[model samples]
Target: MEELKEELLSTDGKLDFAIGFKGTVAIGFQSPQSGYNLKVIRNTPTEQYKWGVFEGVPSVLEKYGRVHVINRTGSMLDNIIFYRVKLERAWFTNALLQELLNDASECVTLQGESLFFRHLIVQSKLIPLPVYLENSSQAESEAAIINLGHCIKNNMAANIFNKDLDARNYGVGVFGGVYLFDYDALEQFTEVKIRTNQNQFEGEEDIPEWFFEDGVIFLPEEIESGLRIPNRSLRQLFREVHGDLLQVDYYERIQDELGVGKVPSARVYPERYQIN
Candidate 1:
C-alpha cells in the first residue's frame, strides 16, 4: 500500500501532486471494487483553507473531479476540461476506495493513459450521499433539490463564473436531504453562454425541456447540430461512477422552467468559425 501511495504521489506524470487530503490512508485496495465508491465529491475552496467555504451552509458535496491529467505523462492543464480519473484514498473507506480504484483504472484505460494511472491517488475526506441517507420523503426530496441547486450555483458563482446548474450531479441523502458530488466539468467562468454561442435555436427551443430530459443545459445549436458533447461527456462520467442508480430524466424536467425562446447560436457556440 505504501508503494502504491508513493507511486500516486510521485511527480513524474501530468497529475499536479495530489492536491487534496494530504497524509491520508489508502483504503481503496482493501475491498471488492465497484462503481458506487468511485465518484469525486465537489467542494468550494475557502479563502483560509486550501478548499474552504462558509460554515453551516453545507457547501460540500460529491462530484466527479475533473480530469486535469488529460494525456497522462505527468502533464497538467491550467483550465477546466471535461474528464475524470480514478483514485483511492484512506478517507473513502475500504469499500468506497476499492470502487474508486477500479473506476479510475477503467477511466485511465479508456482514455489511453495507463502509465499515468500509477500516480492516481484516492485522496479526500468527502463522504458519499447513500452512505449519509436515513429516509426519503417529499419535503426531503424538495430540500435535496434546492440544496443541490444552491451548491451548484454557489460553485459556479465562485469558480466558473456561471449560473448554469446541472442538478443531475446532485442526490438526496438521509440527513442532508439533498447534496452535490461531482465537479469534473466545473468551469471558472460566469456563464456557460459566454464560452459557447451556438446554443441559440429557431422558434421556442425549450432549453428547460433539454434540462428535464437530458439533465443538462443544452444550447439550441447543440441539439440541432447533434453536437451533444457535454451531455455525452457527463453521461460517460456519471454512468461509470454511479452505474444505473441515478435518475437522469427527473432533473431534466426541472431545468425546463428557465424560460424558452429562439436564442442566437453564437451565444451558445461562440468559438465555431463555420455553421452548417
Candidate 2:
C-alpha cells in the first residue's frame, strides 16, 4: 500500500505509467501476469468505502465479481479517495481497449480540484458508448448488449444496484461481452424503488413518470435511457437479445429472487476466456 501511495503521489496527476480507459475516473495497466488498475472518480462515501474494503473482504466483488463489472478497491491519498481496480482483460475489453489507443480515448478537464489529478485515469479499458456503437461490428455490439443484461440481472440478485447506466460506463469483455467497472454509482438494490408505470399523467404533462424520493441513488430509467445505442442495427440486436433490460420489471423479478436467496449464477469468466 505504501509503495502504491508513493507511486501515485509522485505521478502528480498524470497517468505516465498507466493505460487509460473511457471514464474520466479510472485508469489501468496490463499486468505481466494479471492484476488491476487505478481510478480517480468523483465519489461518495459509500463508493469510496466499497473500494477500500473490496480487496480485503472479497465480499462486494469476489463471489459476485463476474466479467460484467471489473473488480475494484478504494483507498485514500492526501485525504482524497483513490480506487485501485483490477484490469479488464476479458478478450473483448482488450480488443476495445486496443482500438481506443489511437483515436478513441478522450481526455476531460477538472475545474478546481487542484490536488486532484489533471488527467483522470481512463485505464479501466471501458470503451466510451459512442465509440463502441459507431465502430464495433454488429456481432460484437450484440454480445455486449446481452452480456450487459446478464450483468444487471445478476447484480440485482446479489443486491447491488449500479446507479449509473450510461453506455460509457460499460466495457466490452470476452466474446464482446459488456462489463461495467465504474463503482461511483453503485448501491444496495433494495434501497431504490422501480417506477415501471408512468401512465399516471393525464396527458403529456411533461412531469416525470418516474420518481425517486431518495436523491442519493440512480433510477431504473437511467439504465433504460442508456439502452439507446447509437447504431440502429446494433440497437436492434440488443433489443432482440436482451429486451428485458428495457423494462423495470425484469430487475424487480431478480430482486424478488434475492429476497428468497435465489441469487442467479453470474459466471466470472466467459467461455472464451476460461482456461481450457
Candidate 3:
C-alpha cells in the first residue's frame, strides 16, 4: 500500500483527467515501471458509506464485467480514500471524456486545494460507454448494447441491481466488453420492488404510484429509457435485443429462481461458446 502511495506521489501519478460526483475519478499513471496508464479514484472522508457499500461487493462480480479492483487504501489524516483500477491505453480520445470530467470537477475541492491524500482503491478501466458509442462503428455499437444487457442480466442473476442504469455508468473494454463501472447506487435485487404504472392507472389517473413506494422501487418498463442511449436506432435495438429486461414478470421470475436457489448460469463467454 505504501508503495502505491509513493508511486502516486511521484511525478508520474499526475492525473490525465479527473471526474465524479462521489469521488475524483481520473486516468493516471499505472506504475513507475509499467508503460500503460490506469484509473484512480479518490473519495473524501465523509463518504465512507459509499466506500463501505462498494467494498462489500462480491468478488464474483468480476465475471459480470464489473471493474477489476486492484487495491483499496485510505488515509485518516488526509481525510480521503483512494481506489485504483487498471486501464488499457485508450484506443482513442474523445472530447466527451474531457467534457464530463470538467463537469464533475466543478465541485472538486480535495485536489483543487492541493492537500494530497495518499489512500486509494484501484481496479481495471474500460472506455466510457457513451464515448465508445459515439465513436465506434454501427456493428461495434450493437455488440456493446448486447453486452450491456448481458452485463445487467449477469448482475441480476447474482441478485444485484444497479440502481442507476445510465449509459454513463458503464464502459467498453478492449475485448469489446460492456461493464458496469459505478457502484454508488447498487442494491440487492431481491430488496427492490418492481412495479408498472399500468397497475396504478385504469384510464388516466393523475397521481403517479411511485410517490407511495417505500424504498428502491423500479418500473421495469422504464429500464431502457433509464439507460439514456443517445442514438434512436440503437435504443430501438436495445429494446429488440433485451426487451425481456423491461418486464415485471422477467424480474419476478429471476427472483423466484433465486428463492429456489436456482441461480441461472451467467453468460461469461461470447454467445458462440456453448457448453453443451
Candidate 4:
C-alpha cells in the first residue's frame, strides 16, 4: 500500500487516467520491475460504511464470481477507499478516457502535478455490456446476454440487489464473462419490495400503488425493458432463455428461501462441469 501510494503521488501530471460516471476515475499502470499491469478505480465515498463495497462483502462478491477487489485502503473522508483490482482481462468502461478528457475541462485542470485520489478500487478492465453488444457478432452478443442473466441471478442468490439494472452498469470480459462493477446502488434483496403493474393502472390518472410505497420497489416485468438492449433479437433471446427473471414469483421464491434459512449456493461454473 505504501509503495503504491508513493508511486501514485509521484506521478501526478504524468499519470494516465479517465473520469467515469458517478465520480469514478479509472487509472491503469504497469510495474516496470515486475512487468505486472494493474488498474484502479476511484469511487465517491458514502456517508456510512458499505458492507459490499468495503470489508464486509468481499466474501459475497467472490462467492458470486464478481470482480475481485485485491486491496482497498485510503484516507480523506470524501475518498475513503483505494482498491487494487486483478488484471485478468481487457477493460472498457462507460466512456473512453480520451473522450472524457476532451470534454471535461475541469478534470483536465485537476490532472496536474498534484492530482491525488482518496478512494480507489482495483479490478480488471471490462467492456461495458452495451458497448460489447453493439460491436460484437450476434452470437457473441447472445452469449453475453445470457451471461448478464447469470450475473444478475448470482447476485440475487446472495441477497444483493444492484438497484441499477441498466446494461451500462454491467461489463463484459474478453472471454464473454459478464460482471456487475457498479456498487453505489447495491441493497439487500430482503430490504427490497417486489411488485407488478400487470393490471394496476386503468388510465393516465390511475397512479399505481407502488408509486406511493417507500423504499426500493421493483417491478419484475420491467426487467426486460429496463435493460434497454438495442438488438431486437438479442432482447427476445434473453426473454426466452431467462424469462423467469421477469416474474414476481421468481424473486418471491428466492426471498422465501432466504426467509427459511435456505440461502442458495453461489454456483459460478457451468452445469456441464457438475459431476453427477
lDDT for every model?
0.30, 0.46, 0.56, 0.56
lDDT string for model 1 (1-276, tens) is: 343335445523222212122211121221222112222221222232322222321222212234233221111111221233334332234443343345344323322322223233342223232222233354443343334334433333223312222343334333353333343444433223321343447575556433444222434222212311133433344335333213333223223322232111111111121287
TM-score of 4: 0.64
lDDT (tens digit, per residue) of candidate 3 on 217-244: 8888888788988799988988998899
Compute the lDDT of residue 138 as modeled in candidate 4: 73
lDDT tens digits, residue span 166-229, model 4: 8876776556667776654567778899998887656657778888988889999999887888
Clashing residue pairs in candidate 4 are: 81-120, 82-120, 83-120, 83-122, 84-122, 85-122, 85-123, 91-125, 91-126, 92-126
Candidate 1: list runs displaced more than 4 Å: 1-117, 121-135, 161-168, 171-179, 194-276
Question: In candidate 2, how many Å is residue 267 off?
Answer: 4.8
* Higher-lDDT candidate of 2 and 3: 3
Q: Estimate each model's TM-score.
A: 0.31, 0.54, 0.65, 0.64
Candidates sorted by TM-score, descending order? 3, 4, 2, 1
For candidate 2, give the lDDT. Answer: 0.46
Each candidate: how many clashes? Answer: 52, 14, 15, 10
Q: Which stretches of candidate 4 lie over 4 Å from their true place?
A: 1-80, 83-112, 201-204, 265-267, 270-276
Give the candidate order by descending lDDT: 3, 4, 2, 1
